[model samples]
Target chain A: MREAIILPTLSDTMETGRLVQWLKQVGDSVKKGDVLAEVETDKAVMDVEAFHDGYLAGPLSQADSDIPVGTVIGYISDSPEQAHEDQGSIPEKTTVAKGMPVGKTTTKELNQRDTSPVATAKQAVPDTDTSVPVSSQQSGIKASPYARGLARELGIELHQVSTASDGIIHAPQVLSAALAGPVPNLDAGPAYRYKLFTTMHKAVANNMIATLSTPTFRVSARLSFTPLKDLAHEQQQSVTLLLARACALCVQKHPHFNAVYTPRAMAMREQVDVGIAVDIPGGLVTPVLRDAARRPLDELNDDWRILRDKVKRNRLGPDDYQGATFYLSNLGVFEQVTHFDAIVPPGAAAILSLGAEQDGKVEFTLSCDHRVVFGADAARFLATLSQLLDNPKDSLCDAAKDQ
Target chain B: MVEQVYYWQALNRALDIELAADESVIVLGEDVGLFGGSYRVTDGLYAKYGEWRLRDTPISEGSFTGLAVGAAMVGLRPVVELMTINFALLALDPIINMAAKVPFMSGGQFPMPLVVRMPGGVAKQLAAQHSQRLEQTLMNVPGLRIAVPATPQDAYWQLRQAIRSDEPIIILEHELLYFSKGPLEVGLEAPPMHRAQVRREGTDLSIVTYSGMLDVSLRAAEQLTEKGIEAEVIDLRSLRPIDWDTCSASLEKTHRLLVVEEDSRFAGAGAEIAAGLTERCFFNLDAAPQRVAALELPIPFNASLEAASIPRIADIIAAAEKLCSP
Candidate 1:
């Protein structure tokens, strides 16, 4: 018995994933919970796990190939013989038996059935089962015209396609049914294939395009982060975490920078949820540190560490990155980067960008939505942020003094 | 201003208004006059109009129904109430052959301005014979116009429209909906009988239904919404002179149609609707037209079996999910 391993949805927004590489080759033993392959979704590259113990089956989707969510990329079988027999077999339309090959029907049988297209064509018409060949009509097969057309084009028999209710074969049902069968080697010829945007990529693209529509302005200033860097090192914290804490403290004093500007009105949020921009393999993601101004420095550091780990693992839930009143993008860690401004992420009024430290000073750029914070307000917020960073011993530890 | 009323009260109010306005209108059926109708749809009509106008006849659907057709042959507008639509089989000869055909056979010289009000649907364990839905049987007749109202507003306005029209009409009401409450806009003009209302708008698929199935379909639509599939629900208020335009417009957008009905699957209302939609919108349809109808068996007397026989909310959701699944 062989089972088709489908590409599962990793995220709420993920529609399709690119099979980056297969961890196991055909005839390899697979155990439950073992990572079978690496799939690149919209947000990040994730592992495709084997849900059942079986041997890896061949005719797998080629690496670097994109498949829709819920598509069977490959098959897993109980034994090597079954795995080999299941290789290149089309997936069943209905739910397949666990660890069992969909059916014993081979691609050769489908080809033989496909040669008689006229017999299947007669079955496509409504209320005329007699028009079909006596044997085919006796079987009482039901399939949509589009499904029949695709089955004929693919040289697959309509009977091989599984249906859920009413036994009517649809085009998608036919396509998936065909996938379980011998997959054509189309990737061999095309050196360069178009990769469809993952859901996260599409969302980022759309957000960036929408951000371009907002009336935004940038203000740059040099900050002496020597004290903050020392304090962060003493606290066993990264400079980005300290910067986020400083922004949270600064946002409490300068509420305008923590407000979101919409077409209707500017909303000033009560909590200073600062979003820390982190670069992953494919793109950038901002995992939010909620209520940074209210939480203790130690707790904030712990949360930031956990968030980073989650982003690396692509396990950030909706709450992990959503709802940020302010954003922080620090490119200071990168040796080549000096100073760069980031487009304000949606829902945030402003984003603070920090460049690499040159000497005892680092250039900070604040991009503000002009509707929410004017040039003067942005300057004041940046100045407050600079003051907090310059004296982290007072601001960073002040919140914990009350405790 | 909108006023909330029970489904039967709306029909009662429509009857009260029509009986007060017209002197030539008469009400006749078993338990209709003295009993204020088995469902109380004609509750106060008998007291207000008296025995002359509201005449209670024997339990003979065939004889009383034929008498209404004879009354319509002259100038009187007769409103015949059948206690349940299941018993309408006894009156089918007069309804289909005479009342429905009189105006056409008379070459428009005489118009059969008759309204047959009956409640049809599965209610508890009403047994096989009593709980049958026979609107599909009447829909097959060409000369008659059918109006099946799912809401109180439709019940109020559609019944009034049926009484006013100079043609024979059958207003099918759900047995369960008689007591269900909904807002009825008092003075609002009735929508055209041929246009089906899009009760809920969605982009994925259209769940075309009427009568009690409208409520069932709406519940199914809610479940579909939770599954991230937005299903558009079209309530076919008028079954005969079937609302093709509204159905086609919805199908043009959704490209998938799931006709749901409480009738049996074979030669049922949904089958006709599904076939009709396929014929009109073959190129627009992305998938084959599907129907969620009652199982092809007598509605059982057992509560669980009866519930299983008819199209339930889960069955409708399953059908919609399959149609929109890709």
Candidate 2:
């Protein structure tokens, strides 16, 4: 049986991938797990491997043509003979140029894919050429060679343009209407505009937009401690990590402060995964520590450093950044900052804003969802947090102390 | 001890002094010959220091400018004359690509001890083709030092200091000032090349300029003083590696700046100075920095039109008056 192979959602962030270079051509036999073609995603060039064994078929979108994701990049069959028969369906002129197809594909286009069996089958199955002409003209539009060539060059649809008075498509009209100018000649170089955005930027945008939905209330106060500076030197860990440990221990005592609130369910959670807001080059990222209330101080130090480095390199996958119960945004590095309020991230109930260190004292602001956690509960959490910070070693276990 | 000379002649004296003081120095360019260069900056040097040391070449500005880089790479200090900076358009490949970049790119294995001199800025009715002020254009490239000296004393001292440094330096001179006479002081003295000089001290406001406009700015400051304005004049002798410390220090005292230039107002070197001042002394500023510059229209060929094309002393005085107003 001929099995249709459609594009699968690769990473949680990927929208579409370009068919860079097809390793297997029409009529070539493929097997399960065989690398069929290379696809270029925004982040990196990746290999698209086959899920089922089959003979490759044609009328396959030409190698360089950009099609929507799940639009039958290629097909697989139960037998090599069937794959050979499928080759007749693809356009003869469709072949990869250089190494890959050159075009941009964003993630928003990939989200529109319909995963139903019927839609996938219709996309993957190749249609017979005997039913209709393979050229762009069979759709009932007569365009001259020059007009057709100009349309392809500009990436314009010939169907959208009217026929010229001389019964031939005018290049100037096509260019003026489609490109907003006289059509650039085929010999002219392709016009390109560059846009630069890293994976870290996309992640930051998503988190900020998600965070705005929560009705966050900011509560600020100054927490004085002379021992923190000396303890930080003794442990060789940043004051930020020590503060995180203090918050984690405090969350364990007052679970309401650490819990997440769901508006739909009208419920609060019990687990604590503290989101430590690390400032990356492009923007900020909050990588969470699972069960931070249970982890030792030294473990938190090691984990925070590793996560911050991952954020800078844009190597943090979705799992590394997700599942936060609360966040800690420390601005103690910038001396001018007295206090600042931050938005609470979605799926998290609260965020704690840490201000600049002044006169050997640390100022903090705890902003939370008032619907789930009360003002008194927040005060109790801060008191417990202060106590843990006073002697962090007493709060952390022996094994964690070694990290 | 008290002789006087043209600003360009003083520049040649400084070059000769540096070449004699250092064995690594050599001169390269078109018509910098026994005929002595188009502006005669290197007049008699060809006979004293033979063909190899004082080399004259074909009109290929790009290739010969590249040759200066190649020569500098092998421990030779080359001073390349672009004849007129209008011709520098041909030599940007070497000036920006090789001469400026070779040091950082090669990880400090070699130092580019090269000085490129070009008689720049609009000169009277030399027409649009011959007259152009692009010191600002050269200032945009990183790893290059730009020096635009106004006085003969600066012409001598800055030229001497530029030859001693390990970096590539582009010394821009106004073409009309080659014949202008000034007092000559030929010692190993004066301020560092990157520092701006306060030509005249006053309390009311500051008028900033460099190169040809420095004279105009000083004249403007003098005219404003009679009207009881007391405008302080600052000559921004160095553009790149800008003397921000001096400008900011002045702004702290004066609270206003009227930058005058022969270049067009849009994206001029004055903009960079204004931006730097804003960054360093934003709160100290009483009024926005005012710029007196050439009109956006092309440099016209007629004498009256050419005069209108550049910022005059009247323009500088008017701008300073506006800045000083309450």
In terms of TM-score, the best-performing candidate is 1
Look at candidate 1 and tell me the lDDT of residue A100.
30
Pairs of residues at least 3 apart in sequence or in different chains that clash in candidate 2? A15-A107, A20-A100, A54-A77, A55-A83, A58-A90, A59-A89, A59-A90
Score candidate 1 by lDDT.
Answer: 0.83
Per-residue lDDT over B1-326 for candidate 2, one digit per residue giving the tens place of the 0 to 100 score = 74689998888898788777887888899988777888888878888877887889899999999999998989999999998998999999999988889998999998999999998888878889788888787999999999988988889988888888889999998898898888887864779898998889987777778889888888888889888898888898999888888777787677777888889989999898888887887656656788999999779999998998899888887788776653
Docking class of 2: incorrect
lDDT of 1 by residue, A308-336 (tens): 88998899888998898999999888767
DockQ, computed on Cα atoms, for candidate 2: 0.00
> Which regions of candidate 2 fall more than 4 Å away from where they truly are?
A1-403
| Candidate 2 chain B lowest-lDDT run of ten | B279-288
